[model samples]
Target: MKLPKALAFDVFGTVVDWRTGIAEQAAAFLARYMPGTDPGAFADDWRNLYQPAMEECRSGRRPFRLLDALHLETLVQLLERRGIGTAAIGEGELLDLAYAWRRLRPWPDVPPGLAQLRKLFPVVTLSNANIALMIAMNRFNGLEWDAILGAEVSRSYKPTPQAYLASAAALCLDPQDLCLVACHHSDLAAARACGLQTAYVDRPMEYGGARAPDGSYEQAWEWRAGDLLELVRVFTSH
Candidate 1:
C-alpha cells in the first residue's frame, strides 16, 4: 500500500537511540568536567536512570514531567550517585546537552529510507522530543523535516489523542491521510485509534535489551518491518 501523505515518527527510539546517544554524550561531558572519570561507565549508569524517572511520574510519585525535564532530573541524580561533583554544571547547561539527541547519528538506513519516502510523502516528526530539541536536531544533523511536532507544542505526551492530531494538523491533513511510524507498538496503536495509518519499525535495541519484542507488539501493529530501510520497501512495494 502507498503511504499516507505525511509520515509521523516517534522520536526517541524510533528516530534515534537515546540511551546510547545520551550515554556517549554523558561520557564526553563527564570527561571534560571530571577528568579521570570513566564516561562510558558513567553513561551506562546514567541511562539506567531514564525509565525509572518517567515511571515515578507515571506511577504517581510525581506528576507528569516532560521528557526533557525528566532527563535533566535523572542526570542530576545520577551525577550525585556517581560521586561526581556538580559545581561546574550550570543552570540548564547540562540540559542543553540534549542537543545530543538532535545530533544523534541517523540509524544506518534512516537517512536513505526517509529520502525514499519523502519522494512520495511530506516527511515530518511526531515525537515527545521538545521543540528546541527538534529544531536544533535539524540544524545540526540535516534532519529534512518539513515540520517537527513535539509534545511541547501540544503540551501533552504521546499516545494521547492530542499528540497525534498535532502532527495531523501540522501536516494540514486528516489523520487517515498521515502515517505514524514508530518502533514502539503503543505509539502506533494510539495513532491508529486516532485514525492514522500505522507502521511499526522494529528497533529491538530501543530498550538496550537482548530479548525479542514481546508477543503483544506483534499483535498490536498493522505493518511490521525490521527497520526503516526494510520499511521503505514494504510500504512502497505494494
Candidate 2:
C-alpha cells in the first residue's frame, strides 16, 4: 500500500483521554455545587450530547458554532435538569467548566508515539475541536502538531464531507494522500467516503470501558493498530 503524504488525527478520543480529563474537572466543579452528583456519570452524559449538538450544525439547522459554545450550551441544559440554574452557578464558573475541554490529558502512548510518527509523516489534528481548545490541549499535554485543522477550519463537523476534505485541502494534499487516523469506525468510514485513506486506532478505554468501544467496521481500512505506537511500527516496517 502507498504511504500517505500526511496523517490527520481525530483528537478527542483518539489522541486525548477526554472522559478522564473531563471527569477530573467535573468532579471538582460538582463537589462545590452539586455535591452528590457522580462526576463520571456527569462526564458521560455531557459527552452523550456531543453528537446531537454537532448534528444541528452539520444538518444546517443551525449556523456553525465552536465546540466550546456547544459544550457550554449542553452543560447548562444538563445542570438545569438536575435543578441547578445559571443563577445558582454563575456564568464565570460555567465558563470554567465548559473550558475543561481545553485541558484534556493525552492517552499514555500518545506523546512518544506521536513523536515517532511525526518522523515518518507530517501529523496534524483534524478534530471537531475549535482552534483555541486544540491549542490549549496541545500545550497542556505537550503534544506538538504540524497544524490544527477541523470543524472551525472547515466550518463543519465530522461525518460531514467538508470536515475531512477541507482538512486535506488545507494541507495542500489530495484526499487520497492524507490518511485519517481515528479511534471511531464511524469517523474512519466518513473519511473513507470522502476519498481519504483511513487508519483505525483502537481506544477501548475511550468511554472508560462502560461497554464495548465503537471498534467494528464493515470493510477493512488501510491500516489498523492497537495504538499510535503500533501504527508507528506499521509505518517503519513498510
Write down the worst ten-residue block by lDDT for model 1: 210-219
Instruction: Give lDDT for model 2.
Output: 0.91
lDDT of 1 by residue, 1-238 (tens): 4557778888777877666766677666766777787655565566667667756754557767777677677777877776766676776667666445566656677888888878777788888777777777767657687777857767567767887887788777988888888887767777888999998887877556644344364555556788877887887776
The lDDT values for all models are 0.73, 0.91
Top lDDT model: 2
**Tens digits of per-residue lDDT for model 2 on 50-155?**
9999999999899999999999999998888888877877789899999999999989999989999999999999999999988887888899999999999999
Give the least accurate 10-residue stretch of model 2, judged by summed lDDT.
Answer: 210-219
TM-score versus the correct structure, for each prediction = 0.79, 0.96
lDDT of 2 at 98: 96
